[model samples]
Structure formats: C-alpha cells, structure tokens
Target chain A: MAQQELEPFFFRSGQEQLFGCYHAPGRGPKSAARKTAVLLVHPMDQENIRSHRAYRRLATQLSGLGYPVLRFDLYACGDSEDECELGSIHRWVEDVAAALKELQRRSGLSSICIIGMRLGATFAATAAVEHGGLRGLVLWEPVLSGALFIEDLRSAHDKMIRTFLSKPRSTTPDEAGLDIMGFPFPDRLLAEFKEMGLGQLEGSPAEDVLLLDQGTDYSALAGGLEATETRLTHKSVAGPRIWEEDPSAGLIPQEALKAIESWVAETMP
Target chain B: MGCGDNALKEQAVTFGAAAPLVGILTSPVASVSTGKAPEIGVLLLNAGLLHRIGPSRLYVKLARFLARDGFHVLRFDFSGIGDSGRRRDTLPFEKSSNQEVSEAMDHMAEQTGLKRFLLIGLCSGALVSFCAAGQDPRVVGVVCINAPGFSHIIPDSVVAQVSKRQASRYYLQVALSNPASWLKILRRRVDYLSIGRALWNATFGRLQRSKSSASTAAPDSVAATHGMQTQLENFKQRGVRSLLLFSEGDWGLDYLHCELGKSVKQLEQFGAQLEVVTSADHIFTLRQNQRELMNRIRTWCLGLS
Candidate 1:
C-alpha cells in the first residue's frame, strides 16, 4: 500500500498563528460522504515532546484507515508563535476551535473527531461542549480535575526539590498548595481550571467516548460522564508513563491503539 | 608559570562577592616541566532551575574526568542559586548580566592565567554562556549541552509580569470575598492600582494580538537577536570555535538545536566553525555519553588549530 501524504500548514487564531501537520489517506474515499477528519490534541510541555513519535504513528494509522488526521502545536508551544499567553481554559478552547475551523477549511470536512491526552483531553471536552458537532472523543489518561492535576505537579516538583536538596525540605505546610517546577500557581488559570471537570460538560451525545486509563481504574470518570448523560466507554491499558523521561519506560499501550483504530473504523463507516 | 611537580598545591576556593561564588579549582599535581601546561580551563554550568550543589553525579563525574584529562576545571553556582546569593528580583535569569558574566570570565582568567577557557553549560546556563561569550573575548570556546531557547529571551518585563500576574490573581480572589480589599485597590487606583494589574492586562493583550506581530515585537529585542548574534559574530572575529551537543531524549534538545543552528548559520555567514554533537542529555549523565562528549570536545578543541 502506498503511504499517505502529510502536509504541514499554519493557521491564524486571533492574533496568534498556530502550526499543524495534516495527514490524508492515499486510498480513502474522495467523496464528501466518505471524508473524515481527526484532530490530535497533544499533552502539554514535555509530554508533547515524548509522545511525538507515538502521535505520528497514530496519525499515520488513522490516515491509513481512511480518516484524515491533523496534529498541531498549541499556542506558545512547538513551532507555534507566542509564549504561553493563553494560560486560561477558555483561551485554549478558542485555539482548539480555530484548529477545527482550519481543519474544515483545509480538508473540506464538516466534522472532526478529537483525540487528546492529559490536559489536551480537557481542552477537547471543552471544545466539544461549545461546538456540539464532534464525531468522537478519545481521551488517554485524561486529567479530570485541574486541582488534582495541580496537586500532582506540586508533588512532582516537591519530590524533585527534595531529591536535589539532600536534606529534608519542609513539605507539610505547602503540600495543599499548587507549586509546579518552583513556579507559584496562577490563580485565574487555576480557578477556571477547577471548573473544568470533564463530567460537567453539556454537549450533544458523542458518537463514542473512549477513555483509556493506564495503571489505574477510571470507574469514577466513567460514572461522572454517565451522570452528565454523556455516553462513555472505558478501558484500562497497563504500561509505564512514557511521557516521563525514564529510560526503562514501557511501549505505547497496544490496547490504546487498538481501541483508537477500532473506533475510527466503526465511526467512519 | 606552572607549579613544579614537587611544589603542586590542590585546594577548593569559595569566592565571595555580595553573593558567594562557590567553585572547586583544580590545578596540575606538579610544576610545569615545559613553559606552563598550556593552562586550559573549563567551567561547568547546570541545567534549568537546578542548583549547582548536592551530589550532581553527572557534573562531578564530568569535572573529575576533565580534570584527570588535564584540563583545570572550575564549577561554580550561578547567582541567586545553589550556594550563590538569593534569587535576583529581575525578570528572566539576569542575576548576572552579560557584563557580570564577562567580569567573572576576566576574574577567572586573572586568577588562573589560563590561556584557553571553555564553558560547558546545560540548558539555560548554556544559553547564558552564549550571551556571556559574546561580551567576553577571553572565552576561547563554548560547549552548550541541550540548551532551551525558550528562556533565552526572558526580559525583566516578563519576570515582573509573571510576579505581577501571581499577585493580581491572589488579590483578585481576595477582592471577591473582602469589600475592603476592593475598596483599598480602588482607592489606590481609581483606574488601576498595582504593577500586577498592569502585567495581567499586558499578558492578555499580548495573547489577544496575532503571533506573527508578536514575534516581530519580541519581548527582548536585544537579548533575542543582538546578544547571541553579537556573541557569535565576535567569536568568529576572534577565531573562537563553538560546539553544541543535543540529545534525542532531552525535552529541550530540539528547540535548542534549532536555535543553535540558526546562530551557527549566522556565524557561518561570518566565517566560523561550528561542531554539533548529536548524543547527550542536558547533563551528559550517562557514563558512556559523557566520555563521548569529552572526546568530542577534545577533538573540537584540538581541531581548532
């Protein structure tokens, strides 16, 4: 089979210019009825770098399966211009909206399926709620609560600091507060983020919502979505968090890919 | 004059300014047999936000290895960090301005009388060295390991903006609960009272603007273009070679390589040799990797002739 062609392009969102790479299938349907587009929203920062190869793989696979895929850098990240100017959930949602519009313009596809990891998933969910026309939502290890995510970041920062200090550092008083990589939390972003629980979004019923949790149970997420009248299908895949820089990290979860490909095939048809 | 083998002295020096400049200075075990062992010195810099103390297994190993390989090594804490002074209240990492870094270089030169000086820095420190080297002609060469270009252009305004943003968010939340807080703020500024308020507005304003326009109006014009550009130009003029080491696994490597590639391309336009090493983390932590890095450095330094 001939390989698909991936084209790199840039689009304007407000005053910022966003970068994206679009992959189109070689043997896919040419008619409007068979055309499909998937937008791959990447995790923030280091995870974005670590998962570059995996994301490329997924984009290729999806394109091969007759779905055009678009992977783009969020604002202030990758080749995109700006320096994290849009630190709020709303601003990121706007970026996602811009990306979707751009995808429609470029590929002539009216609908988009969003596949996101971590905070990217949060953005995708917000976009889905606001736009009301996504084909599917694939969330891999999605962060459900901004407060909890902040706590995790703080813990990681504290752990790193402790390891560096050799002597024990005071952690009790500050444990509750969010401090990531020695930077204090931005309250506006934090407050807005706390309101971004995935279970709370009001949107049209998605064609399918696939939640892939690695090394932990996602029953709560599934239950939360169910309560909100959102149909969610959950699965757990065992693997190391390759988003981290550990050399002995595990490979990308096979089940995660299987679930994604299967969903693309079923949804596209 | 190199100390005779019988008259060699080895010691650790903790140079004190308003801030302590803690460093380990190593010299030959013996006096120079010939003129002076061509006094070559290497300074070590750590990665982003990491202090220059504790075990620093990679740093220590590299320094010791370099020292044994016959290069005098001085690894010190950057200001407001590690054993150095408290963090500077400036935007960006300008604890030591370009002038100050040059002064440090001169001081090191005067203290050691070393003919050749090499700076080996990880991440932000590597970017700092690039800026510092432009100002100081005494620095013969620089080895930047996994440098991040993101923080390279941090301006005082940006730093102040970050702090101000934090303060505004804190105060804004308080304003909601306490009318007195709002009253106080209103009284201070019928319009706007604090630097934080101004910064918060500015940040959003920047966000609201198009990225293409923002790129043209970068936060720090001098630091972004002139600082590194001037340094590369000056290094070329002075015949100082530059080396960049990047790793596939390091988070910041790709961006660093891109920035370095741009700088190198600009320098090459002015006639300069730039060597790029493709395998090494920000710290060159792996034993085999460190050795490979050292060998590459040695070859580059030797090839400079």
Candidate 2:
C-alpha cells in the first residue's frame, strides 16, 4: 500500500468557508481509487470533538483502502466560521452538499461515499436525497430519530447539570434556547430536529447503505431501506462510544473501523 | 459583538522540524504582512485528550474572540493529540510536549512577527502553559484554567488535606445529610467502588509513605515549586501579566493551591489575578458558565493593551 497525503483546506459553502481535510489515496494506480471518494460528516457539539480522532483515523484508513476521504467541519462548527447559534439543520444539509462538491473537485471523483456518525448520519442521509450521485453511505450509530435524540440530549444535559453542579443556575438548556457542551444548540436547530428521523424520511438517495449499530433499534430504518430497494448491510459492533467518551482514553472502535473498511471495500467496488 | 467586522481568515498550518505539529491560525486578514506585530498572539493548547478545540470547543470560540480583538490566535494539537501525528523521536513525551509548545510559539512568531504571547489552556493544556510560561521568554502572559498536575510532586500538606477532605467520613456525612445523594448512589449514577477506592487511597495512601506519591519528597519538589514561583516572579519582574482561573469544584484548584504553596497569593502582588468561577465544573460544561469564562478571559485580554 502506498502512503496517503492529507490536504487541509477551506472550501466555500455560500458565504461560509468550511474547514476540511482531504485524505487522498496513495501513489500508484493500484492503490488509488480514481473515481470514488468519501466525505465524513461529524456529529454535533461535544460529539464532534470526541469523534474527531476516530473520523480522522477512519479517513486515513479509508484512503489507505484506495478511497479518498474528506473529513470536514460543518458551518459554525470546529474550525469553521465562528457564528453562534447557527440554528439551521437545513443549512447544515446544504453544507454537506457543498462538502461533497468540494470533495469531488479536490479528488476528481465522480462517485461519493458519505460516512456520517450520530446526528451527522441523519444529515448525510438527508443530504443524499436532495443531491444525487452518492454511491454509498456508512451510518455509524446514527441518530435514528431527531426527536428521540433531542430527548436523549436533554436528559444527558440534565444529568450533567445535576451531577456536576452544586448551586443551581437559572439557564436551563431546553428553556434558554442554547446548548452548554461546546457550541450553542439554538432553539431553531432543536425545532428542525423534530422533523428528522430515518424511518420518517421519505427517501434515501444512496443505493448501498451500511449501518454500524450500537444497540439502537434499526428495524424501522431497515424497513425504509428495504422499501427503497437499497442494498443494506447491517453490522452490530460493540465498543467504546467514541462520540461521548473522553478523548484522553485513546479509545477507537477498532471493530467498527475494520467493519467499515471491509464493508466499503466490498460494497463500493 | 461575536467575531465582528475584522474579516477573520484562518489557515490550517503544519510546523515543527522532525515531528510536525498541525494547527489552525485564525487572524485578521488585513494585518498579516503589515510589518507591525499585534500586541500578543494567543496559543490555545489541547485540553486533556480533547484535541485543540478544547473541551466543549472552548479554544475555537476563544480563538475567534481574540482574533476579533486584533490578536492572532493559534489553536493546535500537540505532537500526538488531535489531528497531529505522534513524534517518532527519542525524547520522552514531557520533553517533546515542552519542545513542541515552543515550536508552536516559533510558528506563531514567524507568521505574525509577534514576540509576545498570551498562552491560554485548560486542564493539561493549562499545565503546558504553566510550564511554557516558566521556560519561554516570549510568553508574556498565561491564562491557566483548571490545570491538573500543576506540580507533579504533591506536597505532604496537600496530601493530608486531600485525605481529610476525600475521607470516608466526609462521604458518610454527606450521604447521611442528603437523601438525594443516597438516591443518586442507588441509581448507580455515583460509583461507590471508585469513590470508595479514591477515599481509601486518599485517607490511607499517605500512611504508606514508601508507596504514597505524596510522601516521597523528591529533591525536585522544592526545585519544581521554587522554579514555578521563580517563573511567576520573573514574569512579575518583567511586567508580564497572568490570570490563574479555576473552577471551585475542580480538584485542580486544590492541586494549584498545593503546587504554588504560599506564594500563590503573591501572584496578585505582581499584578496577576486569580479567580474562581463558582458555577463552573472543570470543563465549564454549562453554556452560562462558558459565557462567564469567556467574558472573564475577554476582560483580561482587554486589560493587556
């Protein structure tokens, strides 16, 4: 296997310049995937920070497997534009499309594979429907339903507040229209999440979809995939939940990474 | 105003000689080549294992905040953390960490032509800044928030206090006083075993002087504390400013107090400010807390010029 190169650059999404790192496949035609690439969509807030190392490793691993991968920060996230309360899921979906375009332009790949985690997966699946030509998708522990995910976040937020805080404060995240665990999770974004869910969604653009599950009920999502005549590959892998786990632990879901590498190599080709 | 009309431009850069460091430098677009250095460049180090974005993306917000204030900011992962690859060097991690931090300073100096810097970091990042400020002459100021292991060698007095504070008696008293505490314990939200072990170690760990980390007074303990104090005094002598911010609830506060010993108060005599955010946890997980922390930092930065 030839050595891969990571190119970090900023690409435009409307007026916003989003940060992205493209993992270009190694030298030699034997190692490079000439016409196919992967775009990584990160989870929201702390999940984005937590899963960063995983996604970077995944991108490098995928690039090593002959597919160019681009891991990017969505607008108002990571190293991107520093706007507070960037409150629009619809806008993020558009940013995903823009990332795809950037990935295509950078790698000169016509076919794209989007690998999204948690809420990022929800965004990818949503983006796939609006923008065509996505060859495959790997949804790793995707947010099955936005409403449920919000509830989970709410409960998690409440638990964190209760456990860590001694003197109660006035600002409740659910009440204040803001988030605490990094960037602001605006009320508008929370409202948009009410309409998100893989099962509730009408269609999926990608023909082949890989679901790496971490114990979420995917029956309804599977049914939707079946209805769409999508080539579905479901893998149940148990490991550290990198999306929430502390980064210092140096935890990587090796099983998931390997599963993705094998599944993508087999499914995409 | 958040990231005002300064026309901020950010570029991902790779620096360092053998083991390259990856970082994002956010700057006002118009001021890069003006031949006049900005007042100071802020370097945001990694908070624990959370990469350069800091815990809860604190560094990102801070970088933008400082950039809006006309300060060039570089937020980057050290050698092996975040997006940066590990060094294949023979030097130990501590040595490498120190070297790479200096390398970041060099990179910032080259890009912005700024000789002075204000290093801001949380947790391990805080410790890095603490060490860097002592060593690097370019570091004009430091904002160390919740630095764990500020001093590797724990003093006996701190150990005694930690033992007394974290003792089983303390836990028993608290558990007896609050029904909610017991309820949380019942729900497994509070790990009894871990707490039990921690309390046991804290209480009895010092008794076993040979095995106890607090007891073995390494010859360097005096040197380390003195070195740290000397560094702060050096900053004071040189008119360098510093802000030592901490969360009252964080163990790092105790650690900081322990590390500084008596001279912690003398920092204020040298125009350094020490503050505690009563509502914040170690990471400032609350949005309100984050805002307060940022506001405090901004206020401190504004005072610089």
Give fnat, all candidates: 0.00, 0.39
Candidate 2 lands at a TM-score of 0.87
- Candidate 2: tens digits of C-alpha lDDT, residues A125-212: 8899887668998888888778888787777776566545334365555544667454566767777778777776567668899988
Q: Model 2 chain B, poorest ten-residue lDDT window?
A: B209-218
Docking level for model 2: acceptable
Q: Each candidate's lDDT (Cα)?
A: 0.58, 0.76
Model 1 Cα lDDT, one tens digit per residue, B191-272: 4556456556545734543443334434463354455566666777887767766554343443433234334455556444
lDDT tens digits, residue span B274-305, model 2:
89998677788776788789999988987885
Residue-level error in angstroms, candidate 1, position A192: 2.9
Report the C-alpha displacement of residue A232, candidate 2, in angstroms. Answer: 1.0
Error of 2 at B269 (Å): 3.9
Can you tell me which runs of candidate 2 are displaced by over 4 Å?
A1-5, A28-34, A165-168, A173-176, A180-182, B1-6, B29-38, B152-224
